[model samples]
Target: MTHVLNRIILTAILALFAVQANAMWIQPDWYEVTQPGVGTNRYAYSGNDPINNFDPLGNDFSKAPGDYDFSEEGAAREEAEMQNRDLDGVTDGIIIDKSIGHLSSGPGRYRSTQKYLEAVASGKIGPQNSEISRKEALANIRDLGEQFEQRSLVCDASCEAMVPGPGQTSAIGASVAVVGGVAAGTNSIPTRGKFKGSTPGTSPASIAARQAFGNTRIPGNVRLPAPTAKAPLQTSNRVGTVVGRIGPIGAVVGGAIVGTQVIRRDSQVLQCMSSCYSTGFLDR
Candidate 1:
């Protein structure tokens, strides 16, 4: 019994380490953001902490570079080897711009701000740069990150700095959820004893609910393949999106045709009546 208890304790410690390992990193290429701009420059998503944030369709307009066209051969070549795959330049720029803006805009704290600005003043670093330059660049970013944390400047109305937007928060939440789910499954009672062969008394919904909510992977809990259903589902979604747009257009065309036909029919009837009256048909 003592040996079994020791093993259990050891297993728990190991599992905890795994959870911490998985929880450290955030999603790389996305930002949870809200910024002020023209109506045309708005992002697709908006929210603050926890639940309401979303990713934009493309780059944020404020975070865009003046000459930042990615179509050039040189730009593509550079992008192929960036630290963050999709938003490398944007990420670096946000850090630099925010550091500058935040530091310059404040009324006091000139000393710390100047130190940070001097650290970042030597120009940005790229993957193609020398080892010494890369290290120095990393050191600069680290200093700025420390300052951001010290001042709690990560999120602002214009969240354009080295902050975790909704995207990163979601990633962190998902990671934690995954760890919790997996841990829950390991200690779940329903996943044990008679769950392996023939489920005698369990309803399908209850079993499915256990598997989904409890994150269990018990034996005989296999999912059937449905390859043919995917295309139809996608097509249905597209049709739904287009239906409203097509409705008004179809209405306009049908109305025009009906109006023209009615006008022509009325004109013909009027002409016949006039001719009949002229030919004395009514008196006959």
Candidate 2:
């Protein structure tokens, strides 16, 4: 019975030592400095829920097992989708501004052109992933071409006034010259000589015109493969195009009406001034 008691005591001592060795081996040397309460327990792993959360690097808990995927293909597809969405957003804004906001169309076109150039440089306008179909890619290119055409038209009409060609005078410039000449009682107010031959390609308006011409022809230059399936026509895009076409007409009519009002107001002011002068009110 004494021998049996000795054996029992020896077994208990070995078990205690084994438990201590296991604890020492598994306990972490470092703690989470960011979380003081949790850092106090160096042995804590994944908020003490090892089965639900994993912390392989002894940092924060990772997403629940199988909850999130981290892969190159997935990331690429996501980026491509985001780019396509951005392009769509820009297209929508341009359509709305061109159709309903004609007064601010110049700025709208400028903004859209910048966005298009960015998208092109980033390779966002073309098919970036397998998720985008050929038809969708073609449509994106077509939209870009249309935007370029619109910008070209706007630049032709307005940018000339900003940076007129050599020897070419803008209507506003001509009107000012004529008025100044009349006031000074001289016909020697030099009219800008007629367009003198070729304009240098380095000029701002010339460069813009060249860029617009090149961009407008991009769709024709690209050789896209035939789409496997036919894409349905989008009615909203058709409607927007129609409205954009009509916007300029509306703008012209509105300008005429405003011009008439301005003329009448100017006539009234002149009559008042004449009466004031005749009554010697000007002398007072």
Candidate 3:
């Protein structure tokens, strides 16, 4: 009994070590992000006071040099005539140029905002030479997913990172059997016992003999062919890990494994990063 227990424990330990060995190293990339016109004058609007809250929707015409409310008829006619006189000096007096006004300036701001989004998508936010390579960014995010796993970042109430692995599948199967056996108490118990004999590259008689007696080979009589090499192990090394960078941007730790897959699999990554950034944890 002690020997069997020892073997089980040893197997469990080995399985654990194997799992850890395959784990991706996820760490946060603290490198600052860079984008054109970010925190610079190109993004700034000329003649717009940054210190004051200028409301274009407000009725105040104080900032609008050409617009004035004239209550008196004489004043209103004189202002209109003066404005027309100013237009007469232009080369094309009949053509009214609206772009010279401040109202058209808002579109430039809108364009700058679009450029910002484009920069983010292209991963070119900082100085021309300053940036993490796409490969390194991917590698880093995978590591973050592993870190999230270790930190117990639960997705919904049940799922963590979807670590698809042979061991986890085996564990889940064993769990199901254990639960079902306790619940049903059917003839499946015998079928459960037969599962151990289901190893590859074994004969039916040998399986039967193994099932009947603990050992397979009859010591002196029939010799069996040697087993082939162990199958290459599969692990959850590709599981995605996300880490935040810049203000809202995030990096992946093991990007090489799951980088291309994350956007397709989970659209919630952006939401996750947004939440993490709001709480000021993802940057860490």
Candidate 4:
């Protein structure tokens, strides 16, 4: 019985040894291993181990040539894209040359559609960064002109809206747009017409203002508003002419004539227009 028990114990010990030898050993937490050289630790390339030259725990400790070359190539490519970035100044709308990574590399219309649109909206960007058509640049100016028109919409009086008043006080033309978006002041445009020298109903104060600023001329591209009906004036204030002082009885007749004709003629149709609009009677 003693011999049998000893034999079983010996077999159990041998089996345990065999199992231990066959079992697979686990890696000692890969990061725990010392690096091969003086650099960032190496782990499997993945999100957890990002590439960073200065990162103490950065991976790719070998400094592989492929990684270095790739970074350099990427930078060079971006620089090239920047150099070629711009809207196509040639508006022929033909792609004579092929584009490289959204670059306006050729003489085509608007290579980078987004950049061109931004340049068109804002005149600040130049051809180095973006290109826009001359029409598009002018359209930007026109957009500014529309903004001016919208601003003019806020003007309460006909004169303020660029409608000629009943007198020599020249009303400014509507929506003056200049090249480069640098526009002249509205006060520069005159309300004077052919009849202004004759039957103008200018107030003395207005005439003084005109005389004060008579030197400046209106800029081009500003469409002169057509003539509108003048507002009725009191007998004492009939267009700076003191009809009461001239002839009291004649003043009433003149006032009646003004109210019946000039004052009541085309207020709505020519609210912001004038009577001497030779191009057309419809002030629009």
1-284 per-residue lDDT for model 3 (tens digits): 33433432332223222222232111111111232112212101111211011122222322233222233553455344433332223311222222221112221122222222333335654324223444443454455435443332332112213422233334434433333332232212233355321333242322332344343333454332222123223211111100000001111112222322332222232223223322322223
lDDT of 2 by residue, 115-173 (tens): 33344445565554223444543455456445444433443234324432322223323
Q: Output the better candidate (1/2) by lDDT.
A: 2
Assess each prediction's global lDDT (C-alpha) against the native: 0.29, 0.30, 0.27, 0.29
Count of clashing pairs, candidate 2: 0
Give the candidate number with the greatest lDDT. 2
Query: Which runs in model 3 stand beyond 4 Å of their true positions?
Result: 1-129, 149-280
Number of the top TM-score candidate: 1
Compose the digit string of candidate 1's lDDT tens values, residues 1-284: 33432432342223222222232211112222232332221111111111011112223423333212233553454344332322213333322223231222211122223333333345333434323343454565466445433322222212222222333434434433443333334222443454311232142323333454354342365432111112322221221122222222323443344334433332233223223222321111
Clashing pairs in 1: 32-165, 32-166
| Model 2 TM-score (2 dp) | 0.16
What is the TM-score (0 to 1) of candidate 3? 0.15
User: Using Cα atoms with residue i matched to residue i, what is each candidate's TM-score against the true structure?
Assistant: 0.19, 0.16, 0.15, 0.16
